[model samples]
Target: DVKVTQSSRYLVKRTGEKVFLECVQDMDHENMFWYRQDPGLGLRLIYFSYDVKMKEKGDIPEGYSVSREKKERFSLILESASTNQTSMYLCASTLPAGLAGAETQYFGPGTRLLVL
Candidate 1:
């Protein structure tokens, strides 16, 4: 079975604190992504990695960064947390695109971050 897990289910942080959101997948997928979900803005991708140590910025990369040192883990880093950055952060993993089941992403439970 494919499983994705996040480091925390809910987190509270003050403004200007560095936040690290961790995600791990058991499937050994080749692609990993970090996204933030908001009420109206929907799911906006922050970053993605297709291979180890190779990351690509997504639509909303500002104030966000990602690290993929191993095949099973992906980390999303928020340099400095802010009120505007508070949201439900999600981590997902999937097979490389163009392959079977590539469109189906296994997602973590998500970490809801609140910046005070």
Candidate 2:
């Protein structure tokens, strides 16, 4: 079975603190993504990696960065926490598009971050 895991389900951080949100997938998928959803703003893609050690910046990569040191693991880092940055962060993995199997993504439970 395919499983995606995040380091934390919920996180509370003070302003200016560095925060790390980690994600891992059991399947050896080629693509991993990080996204943040805010009220009214909807889902915004932050970053993604198509291959191991290869990373790409997504729609909003201003305050967020990512790492894919291993095939199963991807880490999202918050340079400095802020109230404006508080949102539900999500991680997902998918098979390469247009493959034999479904290209639908399997997502982690998500990390809800609150900056105080």
Best by lDDT: 1
TM-scores for all predictions: 0.95, 0.94
- The digit string of per-residue lDDT tens for model 1 on 1-116 reads 89999999999999999999999999989999999999988899999999999999999999998899999999999999999999999999998878454578889999999999
Candidate 2: 10-residue stretch with minimal lDDT: 95-104
Candidate 1 deviant stretches above 4 angstroms: 99-102
Compared with the true structure, the alpha-carbon lDDT of candidate 1 equals 0.94
Best by TM-score: 1
Q: State candidate 1's TM-score.
A: 0.95
Off by over 4 Å in 2: 99-102
